[model samples]
Target: MGKIVGAAIVSHHPGLMQCEEFRRAMGAGEDSDLIAGYSRLRAKIEAAKPDVVMILDSHWFTTGYHLVDGGARYTGTYVSDEMPWYLHGVPYDYRGHPELALAVEAVSRERGGYNRAICHPGLERQYATLNLIKHLRLELSDTPVVSVSSCQNCEWQHFLASGDAIGEAIRRSGLRVILLASGALSHKFNGIDWKPNHPRLFHESNVSSIENIQSDKGAIALMADGDHQQVLERWQDEYRQLPWEAFGAHYLQMVGAMGGRECRAKGEPLSAYENARGTGNIHIWFQP
Candidate 1:
């Protein structure tokens, strides 16, 4: 049977796309730990040797239905409309796993959930998926990859259901997979006028507030302890109140696929928790 070999919640902040000098300058003479964390994550993924890597892309927002990229091949140059100058003219070429994606669609339907695989040639790419590819050095390997979108209108439970369907589909497909939750936590941003006050932009001090930092750390601690149930329990009462990136759908879906509240996979800290323009970002790997 197909099984999940590895999973992780990784940061995809735009700053990581910049050159080392720029990153260091913004990080108070330190490159973002996430940059180095990518190399470490790469090592672990190589060891797992997954047949395919599926990224739950927080930025690839869709309405109503959760979409999966089912294209056979995608090759292009991309420039982020959100930050064109920072992430511009990046070339990407990768094969897609349409079979696995279609299977996910089938499983979702059988479960009365909405997951549709789209193989349209004109479907655009998002940085949440592309950034990880660049950082993880997926371009150097032949591993096929796919991107799953976060439904903007879905509530917490809906996302979890989608994940559960994804998990079942992976098992039936018999393809070992690595799922990457590509987004951040407590994603409230500093106001545009605050740049002058926050010279060291990437430091924890620059995070939106102390409360945000504390909330993020608390969630991280639970993941490290393999206490996903508590995180989900606190979602509505606590964490969800904060402006989590993409409503934290990336993480919710990833954990949902792992058996939701029943999952006991502990996370290893691949990188220290850091700040990205007031958002909480880190790399924590969960072995499967």
Candidate 2:
């Protein structure tokens, strides 16, 4: 039977695409330690050898209902309109898991989550999905993938339910899967003109919250115990207001999809750093 062999919740910043020398020249590498941390994460994923990687991309924003890319092949060039200088002319090609995507949509709908699968050839893959291949060296042909969007108009519970439904569907379909929540923990950016080779800029309000999230070990602990409600409450009260990408729901979706009942800490904390705009980027791994 197909099973979820492993899972990860990591940062997906455009800065991760820079060369080591560029990262050094920019002086951003020292503070975040993202290279070493992600290196370890990549090794762990390689060892798992999962059949597919399902990315919960925060950059994908759908209205009203959740959407999945049902295309059999995903190919595109992603030149970040926001920062073409840093991310221009980037190309990506990946094999898609259309059957599994449709399964997820049907299961989510049955669970009352109301998600759908979409197929549009020649569409550009968003940075949220592209960064997975670019930074982690994940090949789509080797490990087929399905991309899910974080809907714009959904309640907190809806997000959690969708995750649970996806997890169940993956199990039912017997496909080995990995869940990746691709986003930052805190997200207050400097103006677009900020240079790349500088210490990340920080806003006053989010700094402490970023630090708090870094220190909190209960994220995995809460999910392991099936205390998703507590996890949700803690996130809202402690870190949600700090302006995380996708309101930090990406992490919860991952936790809930793991069945939200592990009841013990399973994650190995990885790295934490500030994004270009002074937001927190944390990485953690769970082996279930």
Candidate 3:
């Protein structure tokens, strides 16, 4: 049977990729400390040597249906429509896993969560996805990847169900998988381009997020026990998480698919300023 050997919730706040001056100003140094957390995840991935890396990014959005990149290869230069200056002309080259994408589609459909499988001769990578591939150095890993869209306009519950379907598919496919959810905690942004070490924009910043993660030892602890409803209630009450675009929805799929297992974090976090915008960035990881 296929198994989820590794899973991570990483931040992709653009600055983690496109903002070097901002990082230097804030003392993030040459290598972004926030993205440094991905190294541990990378190590776990290397050890497990997963067959496919399945990433569900908020930016992989579709208007009407949950979609998968079912293409055979994804190669192109990426530029963010939102912020072109920071993320311009990003070259990306990666292989796609059409089989796994189709499997996810079948599973979602079987579970009554409709999905779309889209393939093209050549497909472009979204900004968030490009950041992940570059930061994690996934292009060098030789593992095929499948990206899923957190469908636009779908109810939050739809994402939850889709996550369940994904987990089910992974467990049964007999293909090792690594799941990554790219997002941030509190996604409100600051209008001004604040300098480095700018304080978080929201009242409930990384402290609140870490405390919540600590209480459960990671959100997956609560979610793994099928207490996802309780998890949703707590998140709503404690943190009015506004996903950066499709951010919250992206993570909802990860949390829903956790299957009641804890992904204990390792070592100290590589926390950094989320961006010039008022958000918090914490680099967290779990052992395989």
- TM-scores for all predictions: 0.98, 0.85, 0.80
Candidate 2 residues 1-288, lDDT tens each? 777787877887787777777776555334346667777888888888888889888888889777878888877777897678988888777788888889889898787776788877665577878877767777733678788888888766677777887888888888888888888766666555644433433222333343544534345455445465676667657656555678766776777787654423366767654454555566777787
Report the number of the highest-TM-score candidate: 1
> Weakest 10 consecutive residues, lDDT, candidate 3?
260-269
Model 3 C-alpha lDDT per residue in residues 1-288, reported as the tens digit of each score: 888776766777776674656666544235456655667667767888888987888777778888888998888888889888777888888889887788888988887776767887476577667788888888987678888887878877777777777888888889888878776655555545434332432122332234433433444454344455565766554443443347477767775666522322232334443332555455444333
For model 3, the superposed segments whose C-alpha errors exceed 4 Å read: 19-22, 28-31, 193-230, 238-247, 260-276, 286-288
Return whichever of 1 and 2 wins on TM-score. 1
Runs of candidate 2 with Cα error greater than 4 angstroms are: 28-32, 190-229, 261-265
Clashing pairs in 3: 2-174, 224-260
lDDT at 143, model 3: 76
Q: How close is candidate 1 to the true structure, as a TM-score?
A: 0.98
Q: After superposition, how far is residue 175 of candidate 1 from its true place, in Å?
A: 0.6
Candidate order (TM-score): 1, 2, 3
**How big is the RMSD of model 2?**
3.6
lDDT, candidate 1, at 231: 96
